[model samples]
Target: MTDPLGAARIAIIGGGIVGIALARALTLRGLGEVTVFEKEHRLAAHQTGHNSGVVHAGLYYKPGSLKAELCALGRVAIREFCAEKKLPYREVGKLVVAIDESELPALAEIERRSIANGVPDLRRIDEVAELREIEPHVAGVAAVHSPQTAVVDYAAITEAMAQDVRAGGGSILLGQEVVAMTVEAGRVRVRTAVSEQVFDRVIACAGLQSDVVAKLVGADPSPKILPFRGEYWSLAPERNDLVNGMIYPVPDPRFPFLGVHFTRGVYDDIHVGPNAVPALAREGYRWLAISPKDTWESLTWPGAPSLAKQHWRMGVDEISASLLKTRWFRKARRFVPELRSRDLVAKTAAGVRAQAWGRDGALLDDFAVDQVGPVTLLRNAPSPAATSSMSIADYVIDHFLTVRAD
Candidate 1:
C-alpha cells in the first residue's frame, strides 16, 4: 500500500514531552513519515522528568495568549489521555494564598486572571475561616482556590505518547542527536554523528538547547536561553499534614516565575520548594554541575548586564535561599505558619528551566515560536509547556505544519 502522507518525511528534534506529543499527533493524523530524535538515551531525561508535577489551572497566564489558550485545552486533553491510558491523574487542587493585607491587590489580580482564564471551579476565599476550612494549617488573609488543578507523572505521559507514535508507525530514535542541518531546495538535510537524512520539514521542540538548534537553521538568536535551576526540598512524611493539596504564594508581577511553594504529589508525598536560581549549565541539576562554555556564553550575552541590573536583588535572595536551608524553610513557612524547620528533611533532584530572554534584557512571558524556511522552532516554552504539551502539538500541526502542507 502507498503511504497516505505521500512519503513526506518529518523530523522532530528533542525527546521531551512536547516533541513526543507532536510526533504522536502527526502520526495519528497520518501527516507524514514521522521520526523523533532525542540526544539522550532516555525520553524525558531533562525538563519532562524533572518538574514539580503540578498541572497548572490556567491561574497565572495572561488571558488570550497562547499559553492561556493552550494550557486550558491541554489540561483537559491530558486528563482524558490519562483516563484512556489508565494512568494516574489526581486533582488535588491548588490554593494561592496571601499571607498579609499587603498582598491583597496582587491576590486580586490573580483572581481576575484566573476568572479570565476560565479556571474550572475557581473560588475566592476572603474570610480566614473559609481559607482555614480548606487548609487548616494555612494562614492567609485571602486566597484563590482552583479545585481542578491536579498532578501527574509527565515522564510517564511522554513515554505513553511515544508508544502511540510507534503504534502509528512512527520512529523514535534515542541517542541520536542532530548535530548539523542544511536547507536545500525547500527541504532540510539533517546530520547526526552516525547518519544523515533529508526531511520535508523539521520542528525543533528542543527545550534547553532550543536557541542552539535555531542557530543551526540560521534563525535569529536574539532570544537566548538562560538556564535557571529550581531546587525542591522534600517535606518530612510526618509533616505532610501541613499541606492538603498545593499552597502557593502570590508570585511577583515583575517576573514570570511563581514563587516558592508546597506541592503534594500524586503519590501523596509532599514537597516544598523549587526556588529558582541561575544554573551554571544547561542541564545543571546541582551547583557543582558547571560548564565553562555555557557559563561564558551566558555571562557574555548582551542581555546579561541589563538582566542582572534588573533582577540582581531577586537573584541574591534566591541564591541565598538555595544556600541556606533556614532561608528556604522561612519562605515555605509563610503560608503554613505551623511548618517547623525540621519539617523539611532533605533536598530533592533539581530541574533546570529554559527561560528565553531577549537582547533587550526582557524575559519572554508567553509561549514563542519561530519559522525558518521549512523549520518551525519553539523558541520559548516554559512552565505550562508540559501542561500544554498535547495542545501545543495540536496548535503546531494545525497552524504551522498543516498550513504549509496545504
Candidate 2:
C-alpha cells in the first residue's frame, strides 16, 4: 500500500512527550517526513520531566470528555509501551480519601464519575477498616480506590519514544525554538533564531508556550496559558511507610487543581504536595525564577479581575502553603495521620502547569485544540497529558490532519 502522507512534509513544534509521540506515530505509519523542533536542549525538559509521574485512572474527569476518553486509552498504550521497552511500570494504586463527613458528598461524586468512567476495580470504602486495608495510616471517613492507578518515569518514556521516531526515520532537533510562523498557500513556514523550514503541515504540542505559538499562526489568544507552579516536598525515606501507594484529598470541584497530596513514586520514594500557585514566569520552577513581563501579562489580562475575584481565597491558601512548610504539612497530615513535619524533609524541583484560562476567567477543564490553516495547536494539555501523549497523537492525526493513504 502506498502512503498518502509519505510525500508530505510535517513539522512538529515542542519536544515534549506529545510532540515526540506524534512524530513517532507519523513516522511509524509512514505518514510523512517528520521533523520535531524543541526549544530546550533536551526533550521532556519541562512539563514531561517535572510531573509526579502518575498514570491517572480516569477517576475525576467528566465522562465523555477528552480527558476521560484519552486517559483510558492512553493508560493501556503507556503500559504496553513500557512493557515493549522494558521500562519500569508499577501499579501503585490510588486512594482518594474524604477526611470528614463534610467531604463525603464530594467523594461520592468522584465515585460516581469513576464508575461512569469505567475505572477498573474501583471500590467505594465507607468503613474505616476497609480504607485501612489499602492505606493503613490513612485518616478518612470514606474513600474511593483505583487499584490500576500506576506510575512510571515519563522522561524515560519520552526518550524511548524518540528512539522509535529515529528508528522509523523521523528527525528531532534540540534547542530549535520556533520563534516565528507564517501560514500561507496551505503550508507553514516555521522559523527559529538559527534556522527556518517550510512544511505541508505543522502541529504544536507546546505545553507552556501553546498560546504564544498559536498567536504566531494568527489564532485566538483568549485561552491564554496561565502558568501555575506546583511545588512538592520529598518524604524522608524512613517515613515512606506513611504512604502505601498514593493518598489524595477529594479535590475542590470549584477549581481544576487536585490539591496537595502524597504520591509514592515508581521508585518507592514518597513525596507530598503540588499546591497550585501562580507562577511568575512561563517556565518559572522556583519562587525566585520570576519574569516581570510574564507577571505583567497575567495581572493585566482581561480576565484578571474575574479570576482573582472568584479564586482569591484559594489563591491565598495555596500561596501560604507554598511559603510556609507548616501550612503544607497540615494539609498532608490530614490524609496520613502519621505524617510528621520532619518527615517532609526537602522541597523537590517544582513543576509549572500551563493552565488555560478564557477571557471570562474560566479555566478550561477539557483538552483544547485549534487549527490555523495547516498549523494545529494544542492549547491546554495538563496533568494527564504525558499519559495521553500517544492517544493525543492519534487523535490529532485522525481529526485534524485530514489525510489518508490512497
Candidate 3:
C-alpha cells in the first residue's frame, strides 16, 4: 500500500479522531491511495484518546456558523455510526446549569442558540426541585437540559474509523510522525520519521502540533496554538452516586472551555474536573512537567502576551483552581453538595485543547480553516471535534472538490 512513486491521493498527518474520520470519508467517497501517518504506535493516543467523550449538541456556537452546522450534522452522524458499529455509548444528555441568577442570561443564550441550531429538544427548567429531580445532588436555580448530548469512548470510534479506512483501500501508517512537508510541482512530499511519502493533497490533523506542521509547508500560522492543559479528577468510588449524568456549568462567553463540572462517562464511571490552566508544554500533563524551550516560546510569543492581557483574570482564576485541588472540588461541590474534597482523585488521561488565538488576542470562537497554497490547514478545532469529525470531513473535502467539480 506504500505509494512507491510518492504519488498518493491524499496524506493525513495525524491519526487522531479527526484524521481517521477524514481518512474514512475520503475512501468512502471512492478516493483510494490515501494514507494516515501516526507518530504513536496506535491511534487516538493524544487529544482524541484523552477527551471527555461528550457528543456536543451544538448549544454554544452561533446558529448559522460552521461550528453549529458541523456539530449538529456530526453529532447525528456520530450517533448513527456508533449505533451501526455497536460501540458502547449513551445519550445520557447534559445539563447546562445556571448556578445563580446572573448566570441565567448565559443559560438563556445557550438555549436560544441550541434551538436555532436545530437542536429541537432543548428545554429550560426552573426551580431547584426540578434540577434536583434530574440530578439529585446538583445545585442550580435553573438548568438547560440538552437531551441530545451523548457520551462515547472516542478512542473506540477512532479505532473503528481506522479499520474502515483500511477496508476501504486506504493505508494507515502508525509509529510514524510527519517531520516535514514540502510541495514540489503538483505533488506533496511528506517526510516522516521512517520514510518519505508523496501525495497530491495533504490534510494535516496534527492536533497539538498543527501549527508546527503547517509552518513546515509555508502556511501563515498567525494564530499560534496555546496548549491549555485541562486536568481532570475522577470520582472516588463512593462518590459515584453524586452524579447521575453530565452537569456542565454555563460557559463564559469570553472563553471557549466549559468550566469544570460533572460528566458520567459511558464506561460506567462518574467523574469530574478539567481545570483549564496554561500548559508549560503543548502537551503538558502533570504539575512539575515543564518544557523550558516550549514554555519560553509560548510565553514570549506576541500572541501569548496579547492573549494573556485579554484573559488574564480568567487565566489566573483557572491557574488558582489548578494549583489548589480544593478549589476544583469546590466548584463540583457547588453543583453536587455531597461531592466532598475526598471525592476527587487524579485521573491521568487529560486532553490538551488546541486553542487557537489570533495575534490580536481574540479567541477564535468557531472552527477556523485556512486555505494556504495547495494545502488546506485545519487551524482551530477544539471540543466537540470528535462529534463534528464526519461533518468536517465532508466540509473539508467538499471545499477542495468543488474547485474542479463543475
Q: Write one digit per residue (lDDT tens) for candidate 2, span 178-297.
A: 999997677778899999889998999999999999999889987999999999999999877778999889986545365888888998988897889999999999999999999999
| Rank list by lDDT | 1, 2, 3
lDDT (Cα) of model 3: 0.82
In candidate 2, the residue pairs with backbone N, CA or C atoms under 3 Å apart (3 or more residues apart, or in different chains) clash, namely none
TM-score: which is higher, 1 or 3? Answer: 1
- lDDT of candidate 1 over 1-406, digit per residue (tens): 2232456799999999999999999998888999899999999999999998878889988889899999999999999999999989999999899999999999999889889999999999999999988888998889999999999999999999999999999999999999999999989999999879999999999999999999998899979999999999998998888889988899875454657898999889998878899999999999999999999999999889999999899999999999999898888888887888988887997899999999988899999999998899999999899999999999988778866632
lDDT of 3 by residue, 173-285 (tens): 99998888888886788898779877777888888888888898888867778888887888887778878889989987556465887888998687786778888888777
How does model 3 score by TM-score?
Answer: 0.95
lDDT of 3 at 201: 79
Instruction: Give candidate 1's error at residue 327 in angstroms.
Output: 0.6
- Residue 134 in model 3: shift from native, Å? 0.9
TM agreement with the true structure for every prediction: 0.97, 0.97, 0.95
lDDT per model, in order?
Answer: 0.91, 0.90, 0.82
Give Cα distance to truth, residue 58, candidate 2, Å. 0.4
Error of 3 at 228 (Å): 0.4
